[model samples]
Target: MAQHGWVTQTQNPARTADAWWRDAVIYQIYPRSFADADGDGVGDLPGITSRLRHVADLGVDAVWLSPFYTSPMADAGYDVADYRDVDPLFGTLADADALIAEAGRLGLRVIVDLVPNHTSDEHVWFREALAAGPGSPERARYLFRDGRGPDGSEPPNNWRSVFGGPGWTRVTEPDGRPGQWYLHLFDVKQPDLDWTNPQVRAEFLDVLRFWLDRGVAGFRVDVAHGLVKAEGLPDWAGEHGLLDGTVAPMWDQDGVHEIYRTWRQVLDEYPGERVLVAESWAPTPERLADYVRPDEMHTAFNFDFLETHWIAADLRESITRSLAATAAVGAPTTWVLSNHDVVRHPTRLALPQVGRRPNGIKATDPQPDEALGLRRGRAATLLMLALPGSAYLYQGEELGLPEHTTLPDEARQDPTFFRHNGEVAGRDGCRVPLPWAADEPAMGFNKTGATWLPQPESYRRYAVDRQRGVPGSTLEMYRAALRLRKELRLGRGDLSWVDDASDETVSFVTETPGGSVAVVTNLGREPVKAPAGEVLLSSGELEDGQVPTDVTVWVRQ
Candidate 1:
């Protein structure tokens, strides 16, 4: 492959359809912020089709899109009203078909978001549930229950919403009186579906087959741990455990595994060996292992890896734990750094605060040092990509985009902000539109110069057009690393720690078919002697034959 050019490779490669996802580098695209084709300020299917070339050029095996399902825009499309059709906010079903076709033409596969835990309040079933009254079959499809107080006024339990407030909401009876309460673990606009209902199970299975027929390679199962609740719907005794990985009755129930097993059968019915990846947050790695038990999903996000602090020891432990946990179930671990819901890793790595989730920044909070963060972010990227499994790249990370941390209060759209009464700024900072052109309106995200979320002025420098083809640019660095990762077949291998590494450094060797590659990351503040091998790539500029601070180097041993 040319140093500045891309090498085109077909996905699946006649190398056994089931093995492609084992080590695939899939790119995650949050559609609303990716690009806008019709100048509607929101990214549409056509816009994504236009930009598939960019993802293809990055050498990713697949693109895992966030939801574009028909919805009322509650929870940013996660609350799907219609699972079978595309939202007008994105485009029509035809546009989605075209996107799949275009992606295939570019040697990339499409894995769409599958939101099965909840449905928008506007969904036909939800509306029917409300109209049919308590104890009706329609209401049985959701988690509707009688309230605790006199005349059923108060919620049945003390369960708190993941966003904020009580997880239950009281509904008015058809007789114009206060009535039973319904559960919505997320925003009240998203009511949780009752997976125990046979109707609910059958409906989602059909929804899966409908999309599978549309030529999608797989699904990035949203809230994969949340479909089932413990029997009797008991309330938790302690705090809502959204981030601390607490085992709530509302998540990671045993029944969810059966659901995925059924879904796996549906995927097997397809020709391309379609996959299902869980966004599960179980209480332990062993518990998480249940979701990918060979007959279930293909892989799951390693939140342990993503949430690990920048410390080398913490990262090494997380990586080892993840590898061992998944290996126990004969599955590959999926490594991810940043996604739509969290602060971008660049900014997160710069902060002294190491919260499990990115607490949105306030103007009064200590600002991140961008220079320091970018160096660490690059190093972390190289370290993650060098690991021995599949990897996911969030869009805009290639351009080294930091979170837009200073948006005005009125501009925030994340439901978490409103639910928390602004005590948390919410995740709007990380969902700002991507910068495609340095000077164009909305950073070339939309020709109309408007976006659903405002873009920061700082985005101009990190725009795609500004960095493309620029030597040593973050974009180029990603392209080069991805190309080399494919050439080295680094993703498919076994990884073991290097014994010679110091405490401040995390070192591992990946034994691949082609060669054994050593990866070293110096998290310390001083340069380290280069490992004894031929240097292939470095996250930061190397110093006189040494790895600089906050740098990761790949060595062909």
Candidate 2:
């Protein structure tokens, strides 16, 4: 395989000379679930540092660590309390520095998560603002409004919070007079900052520079679209009365581009090699492209694929739409099949027609055929890594981990569950601690105590130590897929969907400057004739010239 150097300049619009992320595969590590050192029973920076070898061995170019900053854990660290220091629960600032250094030693670039749209109420700045009177300068730092309404009886508007209630919270003044109301789009503890304020914008830009100066490679900006809001603060009409309405007008507001432009300028002060990935939930290609508009985010997660219906037509449409939209904005596209916030892909797409479990749990299972489900899940993994754009592998996803949503009410950690009346169970399942040893207590994620979240009993069958040397294990399959992606130029190539002659199959071809490769998959239950090609790799047992059912084939010509 020939190594392609970064293009400093390019003549073709589809090809960029300086896009470092074009060929990069990023592994996402949810800090509290990845690994726990010091027997804390919760994952921390030191735990992640010790596990860098596992990430590097997968051949990924970088690792994107989900938020580990000082926080109240309201949204699992998305509600940041301190921008410059590591939370004591995770480790000290020194542990973070060591993690960065260790990742570099393994040739893996480290990208930290930055949550700038809101801050934890415990944040010093938010506390100071609350302590100051209405006339104080600190009051302008957040969205504080006088009184509740014109009648002074209710909230100013019927805005609903994302977590399922009124977005506004009224606070009384220290002198016994009624103080102003504060806005929180997610949780009341995570009050939204007033981006309209110049001082607020300047302060966040300084935070960006702070990390860039610390030798960190880049950031995964949380809620990139939620940075700015409609300045009028008008009440949204349609779902205005519901708790979900609070974020309607403010989310993905067009005015956000201005703020992103400012952040891009601040990022430009550093070297061009640094990366910025935005977590925008907008599924449309045009909307997703807004975050990666050449100068804004270096790349944005193309969540359309992650949320796409598990059908051939839907998958093809997502890829085509994503490619066209990214090309229009002169930006490259990145693909993610699973993340901390969503159901695992294996469980999401395993069955042809999967729905909520009988108990109404999204990813939990009561199905009759468990072994078949696991096999199909392995098939989904092959499809995800073979796609053209940059791929994001969630923590423990490579081991075919299924979501564990059986935690009792008292054990549920997600605040969204309580806030939404359990209508939205939240992301607790995907955030469970990773299992390293099958027989060890807590699956070897901890030594002496129980984990912050319960480890699944099924983890005993799929633990890393158990699969490390198994040839056909899910862990080995992941390593092979990743190596094939790198050695065959599938990550940096032109992608085209093949017109399948049969309804039961899905296939595509990838072409790079070096060579071309074709991938075909029998997505059906029955065996299908292999497409005419030289087979490079097969998912199932392959005889001399025959392919097995539910198999994926990679071939080079």
lDDT of 1 by residue, 166-231 (tens): 899999888898888999999999999999899999998999999999999999998999998988
- Count of clashes, each model: 0, 2
* Cα lDDT of model 2 by residue, 1-557, tens digit: 11222121112233345466876789999999888897877789999999899999988989999989988888888899999989888999899889988998999988999988889999988898878878777878888886555646577677788777888998777787666888898888999898888888888888888888877888998888787777778877655321121345667787888888877787778874887888886636788788888768778888776766555666667777777777777776788877888766666555445443222233343433345556656765676667665778898988878767465556677777778786676778777898889888788887875799877688788899999879988888889888888887676677766666555665776775547776666665566556556766666665555445556777776
* C-alpha lDDT of residue 461 in model 2: 89
How many Å off is the CA of 462 in candidate 1?
Answer: 0.5
TM-score of each: 0.96, 0.91
What TM-score would candidate 1 get against the native?
Answer: 0.96
Kindly provide the TM-score of model 2 when superposed on the true structure, using C-alpha atoms. 0.91
lDDT (C-alpha) at residue 389 in model 1: 77
Model 1 worst lDDT window (10 residues): 1-10
Clashing pairs in 1: none
Alpha-carbon runs more than 4 Å astray in model 1: 1-18, 242-246, 353-355
Q: What lDDT score belongs to each candidate, Candidate 1 first?
A: 0.87, 0.75
